[model samples]
Target: MLSPKLEVVITPNRIAVRNVGSGATATADAPFSCSHLLADDIDILEHAAQGAMKQVVGGGFLPSYPIVEVSTGGRPLHQVERKVIRDALANAGASKVHFAPSVTDVDEQADARAAYIAAAKRRR
Candidate 1:
């Protein structure tokens, strides 16, 4: 049996936030499924996680790569996977920049949301 590791993942959406009332540093994590899953180190599946000191406004677990099945038989899917991946990203409050069909280049996409927030904090 050949189990083709099917999955979708990106960079963790880390946005440190301070508790509204307690002023506590809380790190909000996305769902475990959203994290990277790799059958092989050399060839790893896409995944993402976010770290924060406080609860983020609206960022939360948005299911991506809904399922990873082991496929022994193989035909192929050319572009549809991209659409599913795009939808996942959108659900997570991320921009669909890398979800394009033509971008065949297999690179990871991550929003440095934490850095942006940090920068804004500095400016303030």
Candidate 2:
């Protein structure tokens, strides 16, 4: 069976996570601004992402690493900023990470994931 798929949305002050397979969702709010570019501290963003991941995954017996798709709310990230986000998701147990275009609705995110999966299969 394929591992679970996860979607993450990063905003300036909140991290939203959803399990695409299970429909479980979680939201983590940062005490301070969590923006990678505007915030004085970047760790807040990482921490919030970690927290949200944990909330979504819960205590289930995960068979494999979950695939993660992240959206930065339409903001473009620098290479370093992207690395930081990817590292945070990896730390939270994601095996493969993908960045999606700015998506807000759940259906839009799912469509993006489907397109990515299809493209990946073609490349293989």
Candidate 3:
């Protein structure tokens, strides 16, 4: 085996689930997921998510985030949800992950603003 250009966006965990009939059930959990990008790929994760959604969902696509917030790690989604997620990721640009709370701050805000401006200007 060899290391590739893939990125690991998730770590495995053990969690408990409640069944309608059974009281509780413990099972292995994976709260995070990653996209494998081809070599020298930028925004590989987004592309991976896009492709995954299309492959996973077929046509329909939804998202885990609310109508406003941009995120893939939210409540569970059905198969159709994946396509929505795919389009969302594809439509999302640098602004998507950069807007994260962990990355949000005065400096980050300035940077984001600058980026948005540049993108907007470029579009015109």
Candidate 4:
């Protein structure tokens, strides 16, 4: 078994990565602050997050701070979501975990309403 090669792509507001020779990519918004660190073998994701933060801060997209504040675009890891994460981390042998809070997208309601309207129109 070998580690996959990762290709990092940094944008002004986004940070993304691709596994070399694979279609798998992971991305997150930039300028994130570290809320917690998990003491486990999940350092890959943590390192990627740090890299994205560095790019954004280094590029002057956001001010430099001791902690990188990442914006997760409103979807918070709570409720059922939190449960799913806890299960995954536990399964992965994570001894510790971190949680960062982000504002929920206010547009989710509007999006839902729009989808409902569209569906109604389609039915009509």
Against the reference, the lDDT scores of all candidates come to: 0.30, 0.71, 0.31, 0.39
Residue 103 miss distance in model 2 (angstroms): 8.8
Is 3 or 4 the stronger prediction by TM-score? Answer: 4
Backbone clash tally for model 3?
A: 4
Least accurate 10 contiguous residues by lDDT in model 3: 1-10
Model 1, runs deviating above 4 Å: 1-77, 99-124
Locate the minimum summed-lDDT window of 10 residues in model 2: 32-41
Q: Per-residue lDDT of 14-123 in model 4, one digit per residue for the tens?
A: 44544444445556653322333121223344454545433433443323222222233444433443443334333322333334454232343678889999999999
The global Cα lDDT (0 to 1) of model 4 is 0.39
Clash count list over all predictions: 7, 0, 4, 7
Stretches of candidate 4 off by over 4 Å are 32-124
Tens digit per residue, CA lDDT, model 3, 1-124: 0111111121122112122122222222332233321112224434543443233223344332211222222233333333433343435221122122332212425678799999999999
Q: Can you give the TM-score per candidate against the true fold?
A: 0.23, 0.66, 0.22, 0.26
Write candidate 1's Cα lDDT for 8-106 as tens digits.
Answer: 223233222333333344333343222332111111112321233102222354222122211111212224344443443334333332432323432
Better of 2 and 4 by TM-score: 2
Tens digit of lDDT per residue, candidate 2, span 1-124?
3567899887677779999877889998885354345223456766776677667676643445789999877766656566767776777678888989563223436688899999999999
Which has the higher lDDT value, candidate number 3 or candidate number 4?
A: 4
Candidate 3, residue 100: lDDT: 21
Candidate 2 residue runs with Cα over 4 Å from true position: 31-43, 60-63, 101-124
Which pairs clash (backbone N, Cα, C closer than 3 Å) in model 4?
31-69, 32-68, 32-69, 32-70, 33-68, 33-69, 33-70
